[model samples]
Target chain A: MHIPDGFLNIPVSAGAAALSIGAVSLAVKKVQKTIEDRLVPLMGVLAAFIFAAQMFNFPVAGGTSGHLLGGMLAVVVVGPWAAMIVLTCVLIVQCLLFQDGGLLALGANVLNMAVIGVLCGWVAKKATNFLSRTAAIFIGSWISVVAAAAAAAAEMAISDTAPFATVLVAMVSVHAIIGTGEGVITILVVSFLKRVKPEIVEDGACRAL
Target chain B: MKNRKFIVFSLLACAAVVVFAAVFASSYPDGLEQVASKMGFENKMSGINLMGAPMPDYGLALFGAGPFSTLVAGLSGLAAVFLATTASGWAIKRLRRSGNG
Candidate 1:
């Protein structure tokens, strides 16, 4: 869920931006511990994979397409700190080069997509791991994307972009379906990595924070 | 020392994936745009005129009806990754030296 420009007010966006800066700072530091020998290259490949995955957008509803957000993917594959850096990089590229998002609102978008998305996904995975792998995947994927969407909606609502209820309903409803796709994709990809490259999954490569 | 290989490997892999991503990126509106279209809120969204641009879609100005635009978008994303990661790395290094990290 890439948030375009004008969705958030200056104050809310700025506040979120500040918080994002702090979170990213923390992430960078945390990643330093595990970002070396095995994790860095894996993180790079994972970033590329996430970037590539984002390109394959499947149609959702109302003529819109949803792709893998990869917040959960990054967290499960790498770790939260590295995921933060990876996602921030991805969002920045989308905004600056592709012109997919607004420059002014990059911070807010990164906060929602990078920081909140990864953490929520990680928490959900941790919470649901006691269940079946499918359940864990579903819960992780669903919660992560929803959290990002809700954060985006909350930013919009706080910024007065749209009515809070309208934004919430629209953002959350569509993303719920999108989350299913995300969950499925994440689970499948993770499973694949586990099978083909067990080291990436087991070693926890690129873990910063 | 041990982590250096991982960092280098990840960076190179990201570069390779970016190439493929650019070549095959779906030409579909994402979540926000989709919501706007379906909910009829697209008109409410305003556009900006950065660099005297005409067509709003990224493909218009950069590539203009060709794969080059997509390629450039993907490469541009790589550029962003370089800049963002470099900056983040520097920021962390500085913070650590300052005894804050």
Candidate 2:
């Protein structure tokens, strides 16, 4: 979910902004140092796909809808550093072009969806390394959305915009459903990639599928 | 899908979604908005009208709220995102290379 402006207090916003900036700079460095030349277009593809995918929000449950967050998918394809940059690009484009999100809250969105979401989801996927490629990516994508929502709820609570317990439960529970949508789309896209470009998909075979 | 074919196929997929979003994207509130509305914090939004943005909410002011408007707007966004990502990646790579030399 794209957090609007005024959802975060000045301190929380500023702190998140600082962290996002620092992390993005580090991402640039890490990506540049280790990024394969072939991966550049792939990054562009991911960023564009995310930006477009976010536009198509599908209904989830109880009058709520969700879209693919794409962070986990990015990580699965391009690794965290490049995925971070890719996500930051999509978030910024949404902010400045689509106004789907707010400028003041850009930092929090990046921090939540790009940094925390990707990294934590990466951990979860790595933890489930024993699983098939399909399963791991789906689980990871699901976790990314939940983790991002949790971070957003935490920021709102810290800003006193919403009650901690109620908002946290609401955000987490609803996002847990939304996470399923994220997982499904990530699987669909990754599976498509695996079929078309086997080299790019790393483990093109899924043990279960 | 690598290089030209990859970029081309990706853009086509993005364009297809752009049309899908313009035509039939869900209008329901997302989880955050649903929660905020339920919890009485929905009005906490600053409602900043970004006058500078070319497309707001993925619709063009010129074409108004119809599907065609959304179509043009979504296409514009797709092009913008693709260009921006590629340009930024190239620029960052150049910057990193310059630091080494």
Candidate 3:
């Protein structure tokens, strides 16, 4: 979710921005340390795909719509570090070019999706691989969306944009359904990639499918 | 599939989504927006975009709000994201090379 400016006060926004900057910088370093040759163009296409996928907001329930956040999807293709960079770039482009997100809240959005979302998804995938490959990716992806929404809700609540309990409940509940859609999309794409180009789906999770 | 072919396929998929979104993206407010509206804090969104993006909400302001405008804007965004990430990846790889050398 791209947070708007007024949702957070200056301090919270700045704090999130600082943390986001650190995370992005670390991501850059990690990618530099060891990046695969194929990943160069692969990252390009994945970024484009994620950006495009976010455009179609399918209606969910109660007059709410949801779109593919793509953090977990990107992570399944690339590792967490590169996924962060990819997501940060997407968020930045959305804010600067499309104005989809508030410029002042860019850092917070990046923190929520690029940093927290990717890592949570990666951890979930890694932990649950024993269950089944597809299941792990699905569960991991669902968690990523919920984690990002939770983080966003926490930020707004802390900012007094809304009541903490209610914001958390509302955001989480809506996103839980949205996250399933995310999982389905992720599974569809990852499965397609795994079938088409087995090596490309690094998955970064243990166990082979 | 070759890496080259896969790249082409994915790019085509990206373009397909953009065009699809141009024609049929849902207008409903998303989860956060829905929550904000229900909670009566949607007004909290200042909606002040510091950087006036040429294409706000995937439609070019210069052009009338139409499917074609969205198609143009979406393609532009897809290209922008593709190039930005590609450049970043290249820069990182180059830096790594020089560091190791």
User: What are the lDDT scores of the predictions, listed in order?
Assistant: 0.71, 0.85, 0.89
- DockQ for every model comes to 0.34, 0.73, 0.79
CA RMSD for every model?
A: 3.9, 3.1, 2.2
Tell me each candidate's i-RMS in Å: 4.4, 1.6, 1.4
TM-score of each model, paired residue for residue: 0.82, 0.95, 0.96
**lDDT against true structure, model 1:** 0.71
Top model number, TM-score: 3
Which segments of model 2 are wrong by more than 4 Å?
A203-209
How do the residues B1-101 of candidate 2 rate in per-residue lDDT, one tens digit apiece? 45579779878988998899988989899899999999999999987864466788778888888889988988888788888888888888788778851
Query: What tens-digit string does per-residue lDDT give for candidate 3 at B12-78?
Result: 9889999998788888999999999999999888877688778887888778899999999999999
* Candidate 3 stretches greater than 4 Å from native: A202-209
lDDT of 3 by residue, A85-129 (tens): 999989999999988889999999999999999999989998999
Ten-residue region with minimum lDDT total, candidate 1 chain A: A200-209
Output the worst ten-in-a-row residue range by lDDT, candidate 2 chain A. A200-209
